[model samples]
Target: MESYFRYDRMMPREYQRRIAENVIAKGNSLVILPTGLGKTAIALLVADKYLREGKRVLFLAPTKPLCEQHRKSFEELMKLEKGDVVLITGELNAEKRRGMWEAGRVIVATPQCVKNDLKKERMRLNFGLVVLDEVHRAVGNYAYTFVAEECRRSGLHLLGLTASPGSSKEKIEKMSELLGVKNIEIREETDEDVRKYVQPIEIRWETVEFPSEMDEIRKLLEQMIEERMEVLRKFEWIKAKNFRSLSKRVLMQVRERIERSSGGVKWMGLSQHAALMNLLHAHELLETQGASTFAEFFGRMEAKEKKSKAVMRILKDGRVKLALEKASQLKVDHPKLEKLRQIIETGKGKMYIVFVQYRDQVKKVVEELNKIPGVRAERFVGKREGVTQEEQKRTIERFRNGEFNVLVASSIGEEGLDIPAVDCVIFYEPIPSEIRNIQRRGRTARTRPGEVIILITKNTRDEAYYWVARSRERKMKRVVRGMQKMLQDRRKGAQSKLTEFV
Candidate 1:
């Protein structure tokens, strides 16, 4: 086993070696190396060299744990006092962050926190170098782009670090342009330099098919579509209202036919309504892109708001109020929870990291797991209404320490968090976004052997998304390896010329 070396403990490994050599050759870089490939080690190695020259450095990770992890690595490498390296997070007070910024040589923080400091004019960026961790997020609305833009505007050099820059060539190039990167350094596990240090990733895909009882429920859903349409109309869905309003006094018969067809289907539980809403949200993502997608989702949310208003409006209408009361009691069965429980009980020995897209779904998983005797489970989420940072840290630490066998988490748990290695990763639902899928699976298959199980509800959007993510992941791996090969080849060509001249 390779020694668990701190930043300054031993000579740099393959990933770090490439980074060190490149930083010495080219002033700024964008390094794309996969997870667990020692990206932080490279950052630390470069920071150590730059700090020795009395240069200040800024390292931006995507989350708090990552910031703390990088800060700890820097402190150990520089052998500095506690005050010399500090982490700036949302949890810290602005005054404390300002003080830390002024005094610290190495400032580690999430991109948003750094952006806020810059926005408030509380922090200065005279640093010689800025390192962007998980640099793939340099896309629209992500704080990484904001921080990188600010660095460029302030005239500071940058080093972008990411496992997969992006799933597509266009996205990868776009991120590169956004970060102002001229040289892209990529490395693959198959490369001579990487092979020595890169652990082999054995990915196994386990597919879950729905039982016949679930299939019957899905068919019944289609049959009752008309009833649901009427329910939505009562809720003042403009789409339903417009269909009713426009067809009135003209083509009344056609409108009636359409309404009769739609109203024929039956709808299920509040839980199912929530599930359907989520499925609709995913469909919106797949069928739309850019600003159009945002507009569509916003439109649906507005419609839902209107529906709720309609419900409140008719509370005084005796007939409508009674109907509304009865509809609210319509319970949709969430059988998946019990299925998940069974999986957990039977797969006890296999370490699992469970992913649910929504926070409420994560809570549901935690609640269900809690009901199972001898099963320990907790949710890992960002600081929100019901969870605290301390709780998140404790949950992570417990899972890492083997005190807990499973971690139920939301999308917040996906990126940049140092979740320990596990044997199995189970997605509560398939995430359509390629970036999210990569980050989720990255928690497992980190080192040693691992498997990913996707629990897809039959006849739902989950089915399509599972394949969509798989295709994207395969494409991304190829792209990462291709970029790495190009860099290595260029390095060899340059070395060959020098040898010939000698």
Candidate 2:
């Protein structure tokens, strides 16, 4: 059946049409493509085909902003009347949502809203196809996981889409199993067919020297971490006292073990764990983030000392007092801030999205960037940080409209949001996760050629994180390709068996 819809603004690229055709032919398909390469375009094309077949389509994204973005695209791309499509989110009253669901031929929704609807038996999987954007999130207890399971049970056609599914084979396979998608379609920037559409993104590591003044702060925090780890080791909570072995993951396991117990020992371990975790965070601020960020963190801890015995104990420690004093007395900014100013001054990019890891740093980065003449920077953060949805939407719009040249955002800007393509993306610090690494880099190089500047603090976790994400991104491609081949072989075998039976 031919789709009643057409790309009225711009014609669909040849590769997008091919991928859409492939997904429609394959029963349930997962499409992995680099960001800005029109993954959503293929999704719309597939939705159109199903719509023309006289079946409804469900477009699922992770956030309300994303859902609204797709809703606009659905209306803009085709000749469908306004009543033919609708946006249903949890923000709407359940009764109104049900009405929209009944009236619209297509629904663009957030997974949480759909999950809630399903949980209350407000709706069934009545659609012919469910388009799962950011499909890699369909794992564990995520709302996406629940919706994917429901789609699987209904045996509806699934068109899963993502830029990065992560580098872990186990997690990817687990998500694949959850979505019940038996086929995979993967594309990379290097692929011959996709190369023409993918604008080249030049990723540069802008290494910055760690400030010498914060050395005492980091050293003191490391000593504190080691002391706590030693006690945990003695309690048999951990196998060894090696500080390197005490990653956040390992500490979380220790926390889990402590929570599962009930005794004086458990109480003691919890105290030690609490202090250790706080100290580790302080150390990270000293290393990866600047002195002002560390001071903000230390000040918060000092304020909490009145209520938390663990915090009180940490504050009373002699070394911690010295570290806090030193951080407060620091006169120089982290070298990365200077480097960032230089990048903006050079005018390499007219617009910039500076990806900061912490909210505290988001404010600091925006402050610093705006100090540069002709630079108008604003902080963009999450709802937990008190940035309402309307505020976030305005911030992105302001940045896009050139009201601000730089957008210093926390992790929230890395996913699902319909942020426009900037000329350059600045990573305030390297992230260890491949999924985020890809997403942050994808913010640039969207339509035209783009630049990615990563700020790496020398000899800190910044360098370590950069390498880890790079290695994992490479590994992800290999893992996805292997999964793709395995699925194709199995599919071919099934086809031959059916042919023989016929």
Candidate 3:
């Protein structure tokens, strides 16, 4: 095997080297390696090819901490001097960054900042390569898309990296297209090259009851959701067989569809759509999440300033009122909480990361976990929730230092935050998104054998969502592999035509 980098110690494994060579050969590749399988190492090897050519490189991560992480990894592994790698942040003046752009061999920054710099003409695409850390987000109007367009415009080689690039085929294809990815590389844990490096992850589930009273509330909310849907269906606005089968993704379109409608039907459908969303949310909270979360949802809606007619209609519903009273009358929290506490108490792991979907549940989980003796847990959330980046970094550092044995985080923890040495991952509730499921599972079993325990409430979306995500994960791997094959065939076809012409 040809050695790609002479930066001193630390060489890539056979699989990493092969992938890196493939990426270098393919030009503008999207790498879908599982988390912790050394995607950065592959990038480092590829970057060496560019750096040796005396060209600059740009690494784009979604967040500042991630940017710092990639920069540190390149510096340490490549044995680069401190001045060689630049960490660009908004804190620095544009002129300072402009100077660093030319001065540094490698630059790392958030996509938003990079896009602004590119727009201001302060940064040039003179680099040999650009690496987008979470490239699955390269769709739509995200900053990643803008930077990717610039790379294509400059005819610069670019690499997009992500562990789980979503399960939707259209979304994946769009991401590949927008990023100008000519080749898609996906490696499964079952692959012979990858299986040896990945440890076994045992997955199991603990079931909790959907308390009878809570079931009553869920039924009430479901009735409301179905009623709205039924009316919309009569109006030919929705065509779902049942509300239970309808997804939030589908329901979200109703608002836009309503807006495009004319006359009295527009406001009518809009009101119904809004009510359906609110009812569905309340039902999900009561069924899948805890009562306190449900109450919080209701409270937030009530607290909204200048409520819309739809909101007022939902607030005035007798069923909604009765359900709220019933939830308040109940003394116990979501059964999943007690189940989670029990699992943490008896779990064999030294450190646990609990993934919850709701911010209310994140705080609730932390409060519940800390109640256990000898358990130190902290809530990890996003800036929108009032937690600053400094606080987030400090919380992660504290967790890493073992000051906290458990980190109860929302969706923010699902991605590439690098919470190390996690022995187990617990899902506070099952989510239907396959990307999140894979990301959450990747939290554990990176370096050591670990287990994942899912808390499921029987006869609810919790169980249904678990199945949906698992099925979609399997389908996602197939989708990405299909994309890879498609690209390969197209390349081959192009080559054959060129040979014929010759």
Candidate 4:
């Protein structure tokens, strides 16, 4: 309701105005605001300052769909001519892109396109400000790092934005360094200034217990993994005190070491490790996910030719064979699925987005939800899953226009996509990554109060994943705070040293 700038088009909230003012004044900033906190609005406000200085502004997103979304949002918010605002993509011919590069006052593009153009010398980096959305991806070999380096060389102001950088201090530091971020401005929903604007999100954890039959399958898989680990231990391949206590990280290291070995030993280790991994995956599918998912996975394995002797041995095991048969005979669905249906029924007229980790689960969820009368559901998956970008856009539009009450999606729905705000977000199963967990919860509680429901199977990997995400998120905040303080101390030291010289 309060307007801070001359551009009356966007009624800036108090927190947005403060954050934008700091970012613009600081010049190079990494804005770590939670999702639904109007991080984009802050970017726009800072960009408007650069534009008012008669300089071009370039906004970069990680994906074409996100780039298009930003372009549309800027168009709707800013009073600019069609030619003044351009959305650049690989689809644009070089000549047209060149012309747009010369004439456009504002450009929204994916980092890869900009990186390509820069590499080919097709376009010069002459922007006044470069805004990188989802900037946590700036680490490692991502195009964002290349593009940000170019922006820095061009003497352009850099603005990095993301909900969660990551759980590791090293990765966050790398992201900051790559983006030339001199200041870190982090805001959470619980922050005093942001609390008033944040809509309440009630979180619910729904837990289900695996049946005795599924427990039998889990025990068989555990025994098989232990047998494989013992073989590795006999070879001095794994030094871990107990195989049962070994984490996935240690298992991965063991697998890597086996990959580098030679001869019959290599084959033996590789095949056994592969079988162990597959069995672990099967255990997850059966315990955390449903019997149908496990049955489907087992069927796929059964249909494929035996690639490894260890896998063949696993298939031949009477316990595994019996477990597969029991999975096939599973008549009832996962309790989580039933719980999801009950949640949807409660929110009959409201919109919902159900986030699953697998494409098959997305399809299965859509199918099951559509079976209920008056519940319209559709599957939203990535382009890799055979759903084109255009179809994804259309699906989101249809969802926005109320054509579907529920959208079942894979990890594609977790980050940077322009998903419509829903009344609730249902996690089909708990995930271990803090970044993804935060992103999924962020799909709701934007403009109105919402709910986040996470389904976990008791005493399985679901519970482990749920706890890991929570602990990692807590650690991430501490790391960010420490980074911010370190930056502040460094700046103070430099200023004090300058004063001593004076």
Candidate 5:
């Protein structure tokens, strides 16, 4: 017989009901559910159980906006008084927050605020349960670690939630250890129980060929990178046989080696490698992003006062200058831009969110999108982009109300935001992280069927990134499955031990 609890508060789907029951029984759990699949619903169910027992619950999110968002959801779903569910953020003064902490039964706060409060002794770590949203960030010196440690010390029930933990096994292990996760519940979009609630997402890939002019500039940049690599080879700073085959990871390793070395030779090698990496990044931007992005980057480099001879050498090169000029005078927009325009055109009365990797692209994309009649577009960026939290809130509200048919956003739009379902999602370019790729795609196909269009530039870094994200997503699923299996086996072993004792 299937048992359900808290159905009166928020009617959860079958999978959510099962997962919540399991998590509540296990206590310390890491729940990995896809976006729009009701991870928050599970948290609410568990929170209700804790609240009924006259125990306080603390929900931690990564950002203030997410904290505020969760607060609203809790207020709406949970059968609690408006004052019982309180939001604590940096905006609140210490005294005011302390009062709220004492008064509120369910608290939604940014982890940093919780960490600060814990440090100041303004807030007690006596909660019966702590929910960490975006728990993949639990690793390292993030506030999630501090809060989790405090929770463990106080013997509080912990529930960590994320759409994607990460692709690396080491990162997953570290995050699990930090949260003291005793069980992991992972469900993919294709899971049998999950399929009913998952609206179908049609993923389309559109490939564009680089223009001949862009190719010429690419070759020039590659040549410059080769020259720098040659200098590094003379010093034996790098042992790679083919510079073209070298990856960003390999270059990062080289950087670590340079950091550890000493003397003038090390300094020279560092300067050369730095210049090479910059030029390579520029090459990638031109090939994958757009000439405008490449031009802006090169212009910044050119305008910045040079500190190293190697930087001066690359900036002063005739080929570099030629590439910059060519990029500035490009006769056409990037091919991806045209395809994006086409995708939007076909989706006429529908809403869309276009995800770009850079802030500058957000402006450029919004500008290009606004050129089309009936296409109202706006840029959504982070606080660093001069967008205040209030401004972000307003933008999302307007986007939700259909004041804008399209939202051109940076990576900020990818995680934990309450974005409305759209008819389509357009990836300005393929990202290399499976986590981001999943988040971007999660923005649509939420309430109904939706489409995803990925713009990939053939024979460029875009193609490579597309494959990298795909491969990582596959690996991540396998890793999550293994973790789930291990947790199940552990539970069974403990059960067997109890039976033997009986």
Candidate 6:
């Protein structure tokens, strides 16, 4: 750990001091620091202090890549042997996981696998501390709750690390309750104490209008919502008590229609299982949206249901079936795709990273980029068939070395992967989650000036998400600043009281 400080000339001393103070506080704490603000360093400091006290620590992340990133950060900061730290993602064998968990003093793992391991009763029973990274995912049914429960039952210290824990007040309280977090340490990117540690982030917003063809389709689709509602009502797919319950069904239908249309009958027939698997994905998206929302997060859920009902009603009338068919056939570009193309072209000699929300969209980006000459692109997504972790690492290394000028990545690259800094990041569409937004942006501006260009489709769910994220990011920054100020004030008050008593 002392040797690592030789490289610490790059980090701000204030950050180290804050982390030291936090570790000594000796209670559960929620830290709010923006991306690229050294949250991993704080975790490392805490891990070292706790481990020195004969306590093992578990660092939890929402994703495997982030777990790996935290493990690397710990190794770099603590100068520990590889055997001293372990990254437990789903990729590991059960036997290997059991072995690593027992041997490692500092273990980093995805919450899901950790929770499953606990369920399987694989316990060394010596872990005295737990660190929850991206702690915002602590919401309903997420494995974070189970991990927290296990830690509490074990009487270990709890620490939560996140940029935005709660988009709303209820969410914040829920996170607190989940982790037994009694104290919170927040650092603002704009705070005087933290400004020296933050790099400048320039965000450029561009809104693209929907293709003209989709406009009439969108209107006609809206008109048919009543009929769709009636069909669902007839089928009992949704309870009459809540209209929003039917939202999932509508999204599923839309997703199916899109896939079938895109793949055609031949592809769909040959890959029926894959087609149905897409339905599973659509279901997950809807479930995540409906997890805690009584209403739709952005009206996409509600609006889709309403549109489906109206579309069904018109179908019964037989007047708009032909129109609907044409609407479905109308090819609509994401609008920002062209802008992304321009960014890639304009930012010559710089690496461009693009983030899209869907797997299908990721494929579309790769296909589009392939059409361009001398522009090789690769997809960095969750570990799937044909892509091993080692291969993924090699691919990223190649991209960093300029073997590929552009990288088309999914949410996987947004988290803790060791992807090199890019000159420009293009968002295929604005996302609803603030955590994703921050992580996506964090991939850039690590060593030099970087730009983030968000491609938003105007007047659609994309625009709505854009504004929602912006508002939430602003609120989060404010909350972080307030918390930092409170900490400073408390420190000042303590010092003043001590002087007066003396």
Which candidate, 1 or 4, has the higher TM-score?
4
Off by over 4 Å in 1: 1-11, 92-96, 189-192, 196-202, 205-339, 371-373, 477-502
Candidate 1, residue 201: lDDT: 49
Error of 5 at 254 (Å): 1.7
Local distance difference test, each candidate: 0.66, 0.86, 0.86, 0.85, 0.86, 0.66
Candidate 3 per-residue C-alpha lDDT over 286-384 given as tens digits, one digit per residue, 9 for 90 to 100: 888877789889899899999999999999999989888988988877889888888888863479989999887887778878888888888899988
- What residue runs in model 5 are displaced by over 4 Å at the alpha carbon? 1-9, 241-245, 305-310
**How well does each candidate superpose onto the true structure, as a TM-score?**
0.72, 0.96, 0.95, 0.92, 0.95, 0.74
**Decoy 3 TM-score against native:** 0.95
Residue 244 alpha-carbon offset, candidate 4, angstroms: 7.0
Candidate 3 lDDT at 381 equals 94
Provide the global lDDT of candidate 3 against the true structure: 0.86
Question: Residues 1-502, candidate 5, lDDT per residue (tens digit)?
Answer: 1222335666789998899899988869999999999899899888878877888899999999899889888877876776988889999898888878888888899989889988999988768899999998888898888888989878888999999988999889888887788989999888999998899999989988888767888888888888888887877778887665677778998888887888987787788888988888888788877788988887787788755676688778999899888888888768888888888887789999999997777898899889888899999999898889899989999999999999999999999988898889999988889899889999999889999999888887788888889999999988888988998899899999999999
Q: State the lDDT of candidate 1 residue by residue for 440-483, as single tens digits.
A: 76777666756777766655456677777778877877776666
TM-score of 4: 0.92
Go through the candidates in order and give the clash count of each. Answer: 11, 0, 0, 0, 0, 12
Clashing pairs in 5: none
**Which of 5 and 6 is the better model by TM-score?**
5
Residues 1-502, model 2: lDDT tens digits: 5456665586988889899888988878889988888898998888888888889999999988888899888888866886888888878999777667777889889999899988888887899999999998888899999899889898999889999999989999988888787879898999988888888888899888887787878888888888898888887787755664465667788899888878888898899989888887887888888788888887887666365768888888999788778877889878888898899999844988899998888887788777787888898899998778999998888888888788888999999788999999999899889999889988998788999999998888888788888999999999999999998999899999999999
Q: By summed lDDT, which 10 consecutive residues of candidate 2 come out lowest?
A: 240-249
Q: Which stretches of candidate 3 lie over 4 Å from their true place?
A: 1-9, 496-502
Sort by TM-score, best first: what order? 2, 3, 5, 4, 6, 1
